[model samples]
Target: MATEDLMRKALEALGEVNGPMSIEVIHRLVDAGDVEDPMSIAEVSDLLDVSAHTLRYYEKIGLVTVDRDSSGHRVYGPESVRRLVFLTRMRISGMAIRDLQHYVELVDAGEGTVPE
Candidate 1:
């Protein structure tokens, strides 16, 4: 599927949720539709309405981890896109950087942090 189509499906699914959607939920939404392949950094930036600089900054700050293809160009898969969506929404909602960082650390730490 086209990148735009994939994003559309994800947004449609996102709108159906009553409350905050977790990473798992977002994953399910993205997985519901098949993407032909991973998207490039520029494509992801356009889709998320974020700048390439901001996307790089997110990776630099550990907010997100972007995997590179064989040619060393950044490739954003569905999971990475979902993460960017979540991060962008949080920022728009006024979530502090420190808190977002902490939350990301908690998430990286695993499910145990969910109960804390």
Candidate 2:
């Protein structure tokens, strides 16, 4: 599916929910369709409306970790795509890269950090 379509679906899902939006909620919404097949960098870039260079920069800075295919092409799984969705949204909301990095660190630290 196209990134725009997925994003549209996520937004529609978001509209059905109440209360504050959390990472878990967003994840569920984005993962509702759950693309099982891995996607290429260009595909992801088009989906997130960001350039390939931006995606590379995000990976370079440790914001996300994408796997590599046999031919050495970047392969983005559902988790990575979901992370990109959150990251891109946060970025659009004015969260700094350092703050986002810290946030990701906290998230990776454990589920206990959710309340932090």
Candidate 3:
């Protein structure tokens, strides 16, 4: 099945669940095998439905860390793509940039800060 189809079905399943859902649940639902290959900025932008400029801005603001290919173009790995997915979702849910930044900082600080 297509990734989009899988995501749609996953979302439908999620909607049926009651109570607070963790990010890991959503991650598993949306991951859908696209993480196996590294993608360019354009590919990530298209997959996440965000613009290249926004991706660049995210990177610039330290929200994500993307590697560069041999020719110096951005290459997003699985983890980076996963992070972007979470970031985009949070943005869609109305998270402010500063709050997102702080959240990322807490996340980067490690699992010990989970309560924060």
Best by lDDT: 3
TM-score ranking, best first: 3, 2, 1
lDDT by residue (tens digit), candidate 1, 9-96: 6655757334444444444444533444688888776666568999999999999988998899999877777777788777745699
Q: List the residue pairs that clash in candidate 1.
A: none
Pick by TM-score: 2 or 3, better one: 3
TM-score of the candidate numbered 1? Answer: 0.68
Q: Would you list the rank order by lDDT, best first?
A: 3, 2, 1
What's each prediction's clash count? 0, 0, 0
TM-score of 2: 0.69
Better candidate number, 2 or 3, judged by lDDT: 3
Give one digit per residue, the lDDT tens place, for model 3 in 24-75. Answer: 4455436633677899998887677678999999999999999999999999
Please, what's the RMSD in Å of model 3? Answer: 7.5
Winner on TM-score between 1 and 3 is 3
Query: All models: lDDT?
Result: 0.74, 0.78, 0.79
The numbered model that scores best in TM-score is 3
Q: Name the lDDT of candidate 2.
A: 0.78
* Tens digits of lDDT, candidate 2, 1-116: 97656755665576733434444444454553456678999988766667899999999999999999899999999889888888987875559999999999998899999889
Q: Name the runs in model 3 displaced over 4 angstroms.
A: 1-34
Model 3 lDDT, residue 72, Cα: 100
